[model samples]
Target: MSDTPDTPPDGFEFVVTGSGVELAVKRSGEGPAVLLIGGLGMPSVTWDISGLPGSLVDAGFEVITYNARGVSPSSAPDAPYSVADLADDAAALLDHFEVGPTIVIGYSMGCYTAQSLLRSRRELVQALVLFAGLQPSPISAMVGEMELGLIDRYGEVPREVLVFEQLLTTLHHPLLQDPATVTGWQQVLSAGYDSLWTAPEGFRGQLTASQQWITSGEPTPEHLAAIDVPTLVLAFEHDLFFPPDLCAATARQIAGAEFAQIDGVGHGGIFTGPGDSAARITEFCRARRGL
Candidate 1:
């Protein structure tokens, strides 16, 4: 799976994840359940684009991927959904599918949700993988200042474009250059925009909630300590958002957790592109689980 778009398997479905939001979900393979919690604004289809969930499925684990609330298809409720609420949605997804003791893989925002999930639903996750992850960053204040500056410059130009363009600039690690990676991300944002445009009010509400969540520097040290499951934290050396030292500190906080820094790759490369990232993740999981 070279991050090239492939023919999607036919098992994709939709179900209501808490807050009455209908979430798009895809499941495949037939072994232990491996839940893939994606970053903010991820559509189920993006998993296919990135070749992540598919590779994990090919590796003999039952893979589950879904859009988080306020993304695509998922209910962007009128009110804000707290981090715990997001984690509960994950637990509900697993419970609805009768999948337990799941191996939870959290990427980016998914990493934050996964940490929250560990505290909220400990029994559901048997193992944890934090890839290109971050704890609540101190830079939230800086980000808020930037957002304000943007607002001052470009007054009220629909949040959809604001967010989409902002993501285009900040989310992808390389920033600009790789045509394929950028195109793939565009496709994802297009899908998300289409989904959001269907209910603009919902989209607006979700966006506001998300901004609040991003700026809220909630302390989660206790939750980090409460993570008793076997954990692997893969820190990307070039990730601008999540510094390696911070990730190492996060790994250190979790008793007996393993942390490794994948050199020369940026944040997006941790999951997308033809990097050695997936192999490293697969190897770690197999060795730790003795497969």
Candidate 2:
């Protein structure tokens, strides 16, 4: 592994996945591997800044993270992609490292990939910590459809407009009510808006994947029942995209899976205070895997 100004500080190596997507995989600490799959357009560097990896490392576990196909340091598809396609990338990354059955932590979009990985490549996932996954979000699905339609009808929206919309959708309602906090979020989103502008098709591909997931009726009852491995469905209280009810249903679908909620936060709760989320996740790992 080597470090470059453009990549994560902990260093990363490019792994060629089955789809020929080069994932900039980053591994830290030394112990049982814990792979973290992030949301749409998120990169390894952003995950590092969230402090989740450092928390896990201190808790005595190796943390593996990577930028998805569309993100920089990773290959982007000229065409739109699917959730299963991203799952294939996850499976290939583990195989590339030859890391045996492992604990998986999935946030937002990562949760979808994690579920797909478990269904298609069960042997690779020992456990799942699903955050805002396994639920149907008609709102998001419709919004995703509209967003793509607009882009197709027109072209890429202005960066300023994208950043503004992201900030509004990402921050908690309470945070938005607070002038100071909302401004901080606006600045953050404005500066680090690579997810959308990085590579147009790649960004669109990620959006299309989410849209299809909602339209596809995935995680069917049979699919969830087939999952025999340990699973955790962690939900955020104020997540508009995947409300508590939606998240709870996902947990119920998975036999023997645990369901828990964090109060007073939205979809971006994980980022509002990284350590709190990390601590809860580590707690789950310790109880489930004893590591």
Measured by TM-score, the strongest candidate is: 2
**Model 1 misplaced regions, further than 4 Å:** 1-10, 144-219, 270-274, 287-291
User: What are the RMSDs of all candidates, in order?
Assistant: 6.0, 3.2
In model 2, the runs with Cα more than 4 Å from the true position are 1-10, 194-197
TM-score of each: 0.77, 0.91
Please, what are the lDDT tens digits per residue for candidate 2 over residues 1-291? 112225433477877776667677888898788999998887766677667788889878888998888777677776578999999999998888888888998888888899889989988888899876558577678668778887888886567777766766667787889999878877778777764334777778888897887788876788788888788888778777778788897788788988888778777777774436667788877776642
Instruction: Write down the lDDT that model 1 would get.
Output: 0.65
Backbone clashes per model, in order?
Answer: 1, 0
Q: How accurate locally, in lDDT, is each candidate? A: 0.65, 0.78
lDDT of 1 by residue, 1-291 (tens): 011113323565766654566666788887878888876555566556657666777788788988766664555565444667778888889989997678888886677778778788888888888877665355534554555455557643355665555454344455556777666767765554554432443434434434555576533567667778888887767666676788888789888888888776666564444266566666655554422
Least well predicted 10-residue stretch by lDDT in candidate 2: 1-10
